[model samples]
Target: MPIIDKEGNFLAVADNVETISNSAAIADVMAQFANAEILGIIFPTHHDGRGYSLTKKLRRAGFNGKLRAIGPLIPDQFSDLIACGFDEIEISDEQFLRQPLVQWLAAKEISQHSYQNNNSTKTSIFQSRRQKIAANRHLNLVRELP
Candidate 1:
């Protein structure tokens, strides 16, 4: 399995990662895994979205460690996964071969702007629209004053 950062950089896999299944309850393991240096959330399948929910819970619980999503996932989901708080994604060799590094990079580029805010650094469509509206309103007001 090859691990990739959100920026599409190939990352050296950490040997000391604490693994947890997506099905595990966050409340049950919060004390143990929350303080881990690195945590790996096992996603049995891309279709299983429990991992995303779990990640959110862990983050809210103050799990500030490196969070890794390990499973079979497509390049399309890269942005959503990052927004969901995954620091790195571990993909199978077959998926890597099929999608290639370029696809992952492209996905990262596309993630720069998104429709939903989701607490990510990327600017949301709503926020951009609001900024533009405010600028236009300011310009209109200035014209009226003159």
Candidate 2:
């Protein structure tokens, strides 16, 4: 899951900061990449060194997932965040969504993955058709009642 702050700004909090320092904590999160589907990570502040370390570890570990900085990051920190593997950032929903730079960062380089031919698609189509009929009938009943 994408890590977000209280206001929904993305952030990457070092999982093992108290037990270990930034370097060690970053190593740990990197190691778990195989088992996790981390969409993005967030850094709390520019002053916090942990997030930068974490981003470096993720890149070294082959994590191509999105990285973002949240909280009290300064304008100067933006370049550093990109250097540390942050692809996109959440400044404001409107600005983040509308900005061309943000759009470019958000765009993924498509890769080929294995696909399974499941017959579930046909079953789902039939189920949806049935639901539509039922919904129409219910709507008619409600309208007739008045």
lDDT against the true structure, each candidate? 0.86, 0.47
Question: Cα lDDT of model 1 overall?
Answer: 0.86
Candidate 1: segments with Cα more than 4 A from true spot: 111-113
State the lDDT of candidate 2 residue by residue for 1-146, as single tens digits: 22333222454444421112334455566565434433334444447778766666767777665454544444344444554566544454444334434333333211111132221122244566778999999999999995
lDDT of 1 by residue, 22-108 (tens): 989878768677688889999898899999988988888888888999999888888888899898899888889898888988877
TM-score, cand. 2 vs. native: 0.39
Worst 10 residues of 1 by lDDT: 6-15
Model 1 residue 37 distance off true place after TM-score fit, in angstroms: 1.4
> Judged by lDDT, which candidate is best?
1
Error of 1 at 121 (Å): 2.3
